[model samples]
Target chain A: MVKSYVEYTFKNSLPPNATVLLAAPTLPIQAEGGIPGNKGIWAGILSEMTEFALLFGVYFIARAHFPQAFKEGPLRLSLFAGTFNTVLMISGSYFVANAVLAIRQNRPRASVRWLILVLIAACGYLLTKYFEFRWNVGQGITGKTGIFFTVYYYLTFTHMVHVLWGIMGLLWVIARTRMGAYTPAEHEGMEAFASYWHATDLIWLVIFPLLYLLR
Target chain B: MKAMTHKRTIGLLWLLLVALTLGGAFLGETAAPGLAVTVIVSLTMAFKGRMVIDHFMELKTANRTIRSLMRAYFYVVPLVTVLVYLFGDRLARLTTL
Candidate 1:
């Protein structure tokens, strides 16, 4: 069944090896999903940019300066949580990123290996976040700790939700990997999704600074 | 060619993350919350974030459109100051909020 779905999608497409997305940069990849204008790449760019804009608006204008109304109630958040999360995301990103390259190299096994690592890291992220949330709740710091904590919980938790969704997407990549579905050229789905995974990780980049470091 | 040393890169990131964790913890609580350990920690976090985007996420390898979008990510850095600018009066009037 899955095989048919993949076949339907790429029946007319070039093999993954033939495409630039999986080949040497000497051959620039013409945008996949169609000719240059309305491609998956644009959709990916939009998804990332829109989210960053909204997040920046809330931080720079809606919340950051609000006259320092709220202060961090305590240094109670475990630095360990943030650290663990960062490591997990980075590790997972490596896998997904490699999976992108692996698909390019027509290395099905290598791509599968990388994707499995991505899922493993995703699972680890959820576990650590769960424990971190539990600890925060135990400390009696509600999302209502004025604006800082409010924004803190809101931003980090919201980003976590996106990471969780990214995990699901990576799982699909894993499934495709198992099915030997991607050829070198058509691995755009994997590439596009890796781009999303990295974007989600990128949000944590700011969150770590804004919430934990920017204190 | 560099041959893309994927696992080695992951190992390095883990080391950096641990350094960040320990650095933040060792700095501990500070008397000057704004100017203290947290500031250093945040700056390091920003550096780590940049590394993730540049190397791990390979935003550097992205196409021009994607590359610009990545640069657009930095738009928030200036806004850090803007938060101060926009909220100046609000900070003075913060009590009302």
Candidate 2:
């Protein structure tokens, strides 16, 4: 049944070395529905969301407890770093999404270009973040500084870890894409990585205002 | 023609995201923090999140369960931020332990 579906979707001639990227363990193909990348990736996304939701809960409690500290924290932090990171994240997300779009149009080379742009943006994010953390420590604003700084550091650090994971996932996707491991008909891996990266970007959108913009 | 339309849509989304980020930053730095600032910031935050989820993640056409879960996260988080701003004292007293 699944084979017939695949055949019908791909027109019966599977691309050479086409990867069998199933949308779910029970669902072997995406032609049956729109599952984005795969069930596994969605599972990962859900788990990531849960972890961040807990962190966000912690953030709110701390903010409620120390409203003064929360109010004053952003004034001390570098708005430049915050805004720069936000732009990079948004641009990287846009690039990765374009990569997905490109591949869907069967433009593998264009997809690679878009993926490369995402890598550049990701590298920019890591560099700016490193400097931002250094600036914070240099200013004597550690986790123990106050409730607000504590929450800020914890949330940003947790987010940074996820971004690192995203970069690694992106690298793998880029390599696979260059090897022609993805096709318009079977590019679930690329979509999966793009989805994860976009999710990471989404979290940053929330974090930016809370930490830097809300004041 | 279809690819061009997709490209245009992505370009527009990216522009909007960038504009909102800069606009929010300007407001945060220049405007006094108050009810108005908080409301604007929270709404923009939610809007930015939705753009990514719907267009960038291409989850607009995704499975109902996954899409709703993601959308709910975006909505609830921003709404909670507004509530925290409005009732910080009450929340603090309630959560004191």
Candidate 3:
């Protein structure tokens, strides 16, 4: 069943080398759902999700023990900042997704434009986040303030680091994309970046409410 | 041919996401009742995650195993988080060994 699905999806779209890579023993073909980009990136995503799961576990545990703190914590946060950042992240993910779709449609120039939009949105997020942090510290809501602030800093900071990594990935892919390194039939780098960005966006979707809205 | 359809789908999905985000923000602000807010927010989280996974990630037509795993990830994480949010006290006590 898996073989048929893989063959059906890739027989026309993928080149022979990609087929071999897909069938490579080093990767878990069954787990990839058809190799959105490649195996290594999917592995990275799995690891990323695992790490966040553990972090969320700790968060839930802490929230349980200190429900009142969690309740009161979000009230102090800047919901405007959180909501703005959410819009930027979701918009970035949309651009990245469209970039992938554009590439798959054999429009490299359109893909590059979409990526430029992604960069804009990413920069917007970073800038908003920087100001948000400044405002947070200005209000004396540092990590050392209390357990709620500690958890808030830990989760959001970790996610910010991931977003930074994703920004770097976008830069790299954008450079290669401008050089015409990718085509509709073989744009693994674009798909990989899209997957990473979407994953990060999804993580923030969860974090926004947990840290900002759930008062 | 198919790409056009995919683009339309993506555009529609993007609009849906934006709507959900804004609606969620409004609900977060005005929803007086706590439990109702939590449940609605939790459901919205799960729905948004699923949309990203299925559409943005292009896993809608993925292989069965991969699709199932991604679906499970999107579903279980939010569901469990909501459960923990609601019953964290009981959970902490139950696990205190």
Candidate 4:
């Protein structure tokens, strides 16, 4: 049964917190590294630069012709909230990144703790996000941003959904970590979890700027 | 849970963010604001985002496959932005501009 296989692996997965996976043939001697990257971890950073240029260009063209809608919408935006969330998401990413590092350093207990805090921050972020949504909806702020606000919400909320999913995954990993399923050595599970978390962080890095900060 | 200053770093980032948030709002509220407001806000936000992705999301130490997946959003952003600006209104009758 699947249970037995899991049990065997769990029991013998190189000592739940071994700093190095010496016995495992598949595991590498070190964490994966890449080029210092001009664009950093943003995978589509380069490929989509032109696309943004076009989008903003379209906005300029449209704004020049029909300035009424776009002007009104951005004028009423809550930069306060945008900035707050930007900071929150950024800070949360740092905490979660440390969680991954804790595992690498062979500290499961510490790693789980860091992840738990990150999960809390995720909840907080969702709370602020939904609160803003509620306020916007209640105030009948629909179609306020026209194209600007419309796509802004569309993109940000979609990204937030991804963040929530990442948090859920982190929670599951935390539960597993508590159960002693992973160690520094045979921690493909932890590694995979961290990867997902980083991906979430990576997306937020770009979206926050484009949506809130960019003029 | 004490993994060598996790809490402290989170705290520091939060404090910096509060300061930045106030700065952004103050600047955003200014009349006849210069381009510096936009640049400051965006740069601060971008800086924060990188921190989040690198530290909280753990991408700073991630491998190639993970990093690639994370970076995919960079493309998604511009693609969606440009496509929506150029064609979103026609496709869905949703443009306000």
Q: TM-score for each prediction?
A: 0.72, 0.89, 0.87, 0.61
True contacts preserved, each candidate?
A: 0.31, 0.72, 0.55, 0.39
Chain B of candidate 4 vs. true chain B, TM? 0.57
lDDT of 3 by residue, A66-163 (tens): 88898889878888888889988888988988888777667889989999999999999989989999999999989998899999999999999999
Q: For candidate 2, lDDT tens digit of each residue in A146-186?
A: 88888888899899999999989989999999999998778
Of 1 and 2, the candidate ahead on DockQ is 2
Least accurate stretch of 10 residues (summed lDDT) in model 2 chain A?
A: A23-32
For residues B1-97, could you state the per-residue lDDT of candidate 2 as single tens digits? 6466667888999999999899888899899889999999999998999888877876776687888999999899999999999988898899888
A105-135, model 1: which lDDT tens digit per residue?
Answer: 7898989888888888898999998898888
CA RMSD (A), model 4: 12.4
For A1-215, candidate 4 gives per-residue lDDT tens digits of: 99999977876866765536544434222334732222342344333333444544555445434535544655556665666676666556666656666676778899888888778778877887887777777766664536767656755666686787777777788898899887766666665555455455555555554555444
Candidate 3 chain B, which ten residues in sequence have the lowest lDDT sum? Answer: B61-70
Which candidate, 1 or 2, would have the higher lDDT against the true structure?
Answer: 2
* Candidate closest to the true structure, highest TM-score: 2
Please identify model 3 stretches exceeding 4 Å from their true place.
Answer: A1-33, B95-97
Q: Looking at model 1 chain B, which ten-residue stretch has the lowest summed lDDT? A: B78-87
Give the candidate order by descending lDDT.
2, 3, 1, 4
Off by over 4 Å in 1: A1-38, A41-45, A60-71, B4-32, B35-46, B78-97
Compute the DockQ of candidate 2: 0.45
